[model samples]
Target chain A: DARVTQTPRHKVTEMGQEVTMRCQPILGHNTVFWYRQTMMQGLELLAYFRNRAPLDDSGMPKDRFSAEMPDATLATLKIQPSEPRDSAVYFCASGPPADTQYFGPGTRLTVL
Target chain B: EDQVTQSPEALRLQEGESSSLNCSYTVSGLRGLFWYRQDPGKGPEFLFTLYSAGEEKEKERLKATLTKKESFLHITAPKPEDSATYLCAVQANNQGGKLIFGQGTELSVKP
Candidate 1:
């Protein structure tokens, strides 16, 4: 059973701190997506990469948030100078050519 | 702009009860409609994908049906273990594979 994997399931940081979340997509998958989920906004797409290249990041805050897929299996989302409003669960999903996304367990981040 | 809306933000049902969740969507062109189940503190799990009107799919106690304007997830005799947030998303014909998600319906089954 192959599944997307994420590291640091939980993180707590003070305001202005930097937070990084990591994901390892399923082997042989070609598309990766980053999403943020909160009670107020539901699920918001932050970024996505296809074939190891960024296809979209318009939903991300360019001033503080960054998403990168260094290689086919690894993807990362980083937030610098994080604010309290940034508290939420970040999810990473990978998809094959068929486009059905498989999501990881998610990283819960709490910024105080 | 593509948009997806789910009705009854929260629902509660007794064990062995039956109910349906609604998801309405508007897009330039529909590529696919997807259903996902999310547990507390976990990411969404893929459930079903409907590609065209009148398509139906079933898994255990859940069945999903899609129409031109909306989709319905029917739960029959649901158990406590079926409690979770059900999410609906749509992929537009022109948006590549990016998904537009709805607010989701949180279902609670009481024993």
Candidate 2:
């Protein structure tokens, strides 16, 4: 069965290093979203894209974080000079529309 | 601000026992309410979606019902496989698919 797929199910990086997470949305899904979950913050929406154009990213940190969809099949979330506070579970989700989202096995990032 | 809140941050139940978890929200308009089950290290698995008040949906031992301001996830005679963190989210029509998630209720079913 087709499902949203994310790479590097786990990641460990030194603080200040550049880290990138990748996601492949389910085939034919038009909307993709990026979310971060932590023990302190619960789940927070970082960004969302529709048909490859970002619709809302107000939840994202503009200074050190960036999200993009290079093409229909791929979406990426990157952090420059990552910090210890950035250590959290980053989830990638997709849906045909806005109501329901299908999440992928999240990428757990540990910044040391 | 639009928000979702779930109650009973955690719950423990014996196998074959039944219980209900709650999700309350404050949003300008409601598009849908969603229920998901998440394992410790995995992504959330979709369970049900309720679109309106008095609407109910079920699968296996899990049933979800929605009302004007809240939703409930009812587990009936649950099994070990039913142990998980149950999450509730709300979608608003103007929110463009953005979901407000509640603090999940961690459920444990022990035999």
Candidate 3:
């Protein structure tokens, strides 16, 4: 079955470290989305790319978080100087023109 | 501002019981409404997508209906395997396909 795949499903890092999560979207999907899930805020869109070009990153912390689609099949979300409050599950989803997104398993990050 | 809200933050049901979850939204113009099921420690899984008022979709034991201001996910004869967090999200025509998500409704089904 075609599915979005993510790497490093679990991560434990000290505060102020840099964390990088990677996603491989299903082949031929045109849109990729990055989201952060926390109990307080629920699921929040951090950034997204359409056809390998970023469409929005306004929801992300400008100085600390970044998302990029280096190619059609790969997307990445990075956090610099990650903080304890940043500990949450990060999900990557890819969709076709129809707009139905399929999500990856997610990366659970814990910063101490 | 566009927003989505789901009622009854949590619900508990016995196997074979039927119930419905509600999702209300307000947006400039609706593109679509989506339903997803998320298990503990997992990403949300796609369930249904409703495009307009009076639109309905169904899977094996689940039915989803959409209206102008809200949507409903009706579960019939639910099983323990159906226990999960049900999330509702809305895509607005002006928002470039970004899904505005609601705080999910956690459903627990007991055998």
- Runs in model 3 deviating more than 4 A are none
Against the reference, the lDDT scores of all candidates come to 0.95, 0.93, 0.95
Model 1 residue B48 CA deviation in Å: 0.1
Q: Is candidate 1 or candidate 2 better by DockQ?
A: 2
Q: Which candidate has the top score in DockQ? A: 2
Query: Per-residue lDDT for A2-112 in model 2, tens only?
Result: 999999899999999999999999999999999999987888999999999999999988999999999999999999989999999999999988757999999999999
Query: Against the true structure, what is each candidate's TM-score?
Result: 0.98, 0.99, 0.98
For model 3, how does the per-residue alpha-carbon lDDT over A1-112 read when each residue is reduced to its tens digit? 9999998899999999999999999999999999999999999999999999998999999999989988898999999999999999999999985389999999999999
Span of 10 residues, lowest total lDDT, candidate 2 chain A = A93-102
Which lDDT tens digits does candidate 2 get at residues B1-111?
889999899999999999999999998888989999999999998888888899999898888998898999999999988889999998898778998898899999999
- Model 1 B-chain TM: 0.99
Per-model C-alpha RMSD? 0.9, 0.7, 0.9
Query: Which stretches of model 2 miss by more than 4 angstroms?
Result: none
Q: What is the interface RMSD of each candidate, in Å?
A: 1.2, 0.9, 1.2
